[model samples]
Target chain A: MKNQTVLFRSPVPVAETATIAGPKEKEGPLHAYFHYTLEDDLLKQDSHEHAEIRLHVGVLKQLLNRAKLSPQEIDCAFAGDLLDEIIGSNFAMRELDIPFFGIYNACATFGESLILGSCMIEGGFAERVTCSVTSHFATAERQYRYPLELGCQRTPLSQWTVTGAGATLLDKNATSKIKITSGTIGKVVDYGIKDANDMGCVMAPAALSTLRTHLQDTGRTVDYYDKIFTGDLGYSGSLLLQKKASETGIILHNHEDCGNLIYNRIAQNVESGGSGACCCGLVFNGYIYDQLQKGRLKKVLLMPTGALLSKTSSLQGESIPAICHAVSVEVIE
Target chain B: MILNKEEQKVYKKEIKDVAPKTKHISTLLRAFFTGGTICCIGQGVNQVLGILLPSLTEEDRGGYTTLLMIFFTGILTAFGVYDHIGNFGGAGSIIPITGFANSIVSQAMEHKREGIIFGICSNMFAIAGPVIVMGITASVVVGIVYLFL
Candidate 1:
């Protein structure tokens, strides 16, 4: 379909959600928000790959438990991770035993999963579905950049990859107040930014494109939502978005970036704040979800952005193409 | 709505202003002092070796000094001490031979769980492999020059 907008006829309720993070992430500003925090990044697993899988399994189990449901009760599972071949999600699905749909949009996997999960329910394909995404700093570092032991100095433009996993269960008939109302699938937008270290520069334009498109298609303005959240744009990209939005007359008065909100930039040495799929996953599933439950947030526009560049492509001097998926969540009193 | 060429340039400038600036002064100062201290220590060790091994030739003494530094660094890395020093010293600890030793030993320790042959032995020099390769290549070039001379 040429149309990117998918306004749902039936509102999908997020019945339950859970988030798990490493010690560093738990020590961040949103420490009190997460459901579980690991003492170490590895979760006592031998390899980071295994630890990532464990994290995914942990969150899924917690979400299922909290919803008072089992894996067998889930009609489908939409999950992914920032791993080559999506092995982390694949490994986790082996234990999940649910019909799995693996997705990969780099750091935007969480939003992609949410959009698809909402589609499946709205289309009456499934009554209950679980949407999840995982990212571990160790795994992503070794895969994309360097080994932890290398002690390579990070560029100021770079962001710390988040070590966390977040999962949410959506039910068609659930009595939950928070509901997914609409979604806008993002197109691949490239600004020809080649520096992999400055991913925020590569992704900000994509976030802007998606946000603008979503607002235009819905015939709504920024004030239509209580707050607008962009996933993993960090400090620089978030500021750039605000600048561009103001220039285009789309003043985002209550805008927050998951990347900037995930960590205390001054206290933690997170140069440009946090990145990776878990940035939005943890922030949305933990903090934003809590706000919805408390009736504090009536509606929110979540635009999780992703820089779609493989290590091979970046190494070969290719510019990063970015994507963002926006989902409108409204609390149904 | 991808930005055009001129718009990209304008946006890039804005991004540069908004981006976090690298802390060069503190990092440079830390690297300078740390690197200087390690070099000073090397000189001290060289002097001590000269007195201890008076019978040995100057080149042999130099070799012994290098070995001692590497041994010291290996021990520090094994005891999880070099990591702290490296964190604090930044480029200083890395510019010395001790830094080279720390890299290999730490990588070996990290992969020790994968077993001996593949994990420890094979992957020990994964990070330092480039340095070793370049060192050998450079030495071969010097050897060729020496032959011509």
Candidate 2:
């Protein structure tokens, strides 16, 4: 059986997020998001909350304002960031009147939140929900995977996270326009690919399987949507996704994948490809919404894939298990 | 049988075996040291990467490269190279995301021998799937407030 469902997506344009910071002169190493040097005085305090968390607050606040909503109106905040205690989202949301629930999805956090917020709204669980996520270069580096200061040259398959955050508003108002239709959750898949330098290969088969199942379960054809967006698959992952999807009979050999676009603007900075929860988040908020408003696209399917692994598990010597979730969204006149 | 060259060498002699008492102690020491070693390596890497790439390290970002280490580690684990690191490092391997990768594929291969469906062929995210769900759910709840309010 094929799956068929439609969603109402927003067309809100994102503003230039608040702050992008690097380590101080005597503080520490810099991040991979930008190459700009920070003035020493600002970097001096390094501050009460980690400067990283503070920056996330600014990004979140900026997006919230753009959505034309005030923080006090939100129910519980559905926030996730790539930090230990989810300090960025957790702390930032603390000042708000709503409750907080911190999440961790590596890069899949954004999609995960959207699905949840949509479900809650659709289920009568809540109204006017928001989904947001943040990832920092240094915080993520030090956690489950590796260090930021490694100074190691990135491979052609590597990606850089956009130093940004993305948040979306989901409501049940038919008048508001965008609708949340249906979704298909993915299971982890491994194609026996095992080169750390080649994530696209490792995760490609998983993304392919999920997309096929998602389409099949919904009983929908490929032509149903204006665009099909993915999480942080980067260049190799996107190419591999196309190759694998072709074998499955989906024939997506010529379409655009979001990860390919997020880093397109900063191609020279990355190695193999571009990815990060922010890659899709940035492009979606920064570009996709504006295009939709301009009538360039009417509908799109958003799918963000996640590779699940933990520091304890990595040390235990395990292979990555991948998952993806699909959401269909449309703009109504 | 005659005892020995000397008038009465016993043909058979009995000796009492003494079991080593350090077994438990060794086990605990191994666990503690192995765990410590893995943490040290991760901390070192974190310090170095954060130091070298100050721009990438100090702030929150949503981009492609924030995950080089996670992505790279996933690849190494798939290649069987990371498995070796696990075997040698033991708890050190188990303490990081690379260890999680090793476990998933190892279990997948073990079940694969049973046949794809009944065996290694189950959810690719069998082990880590829940974490993804919960992580996303938690974030959604928090993000709703951050964005809406």
Interface C-alpha RMSD after superposing true interface residues, each candidate, one decimal: 2.9, 24.7
For model 1, residues A130-209, the per-residue Cα lDDT tens digits are 99999999888877875566534677888999999999899999999899999999999999788898988889889988
Cα TM-score per model = 0.93, 0.59
> Best candidate per TM-score, number?
1
Per residue, candidate 2 scores C-alpha lDDT tens digits across A237-295 of 77667765776678773356556665442434454445556555655654666566567
> Once all C-alphas are superposed, what RMSD does model 1 give against the true structure?
2.3
Model 1, position A323: C-alpha lDDT score? 96
Question: Can you tell me which runs of candidate 2 are displaced by over 4 Å?
Answer: A1-49, A144-146, A192-197, A265-267, B1-149
Indicate the TM-score of model 2. 0.59
Best by lDDT: 1
Give residue A333's error in model 2 in angstroms.
2.9
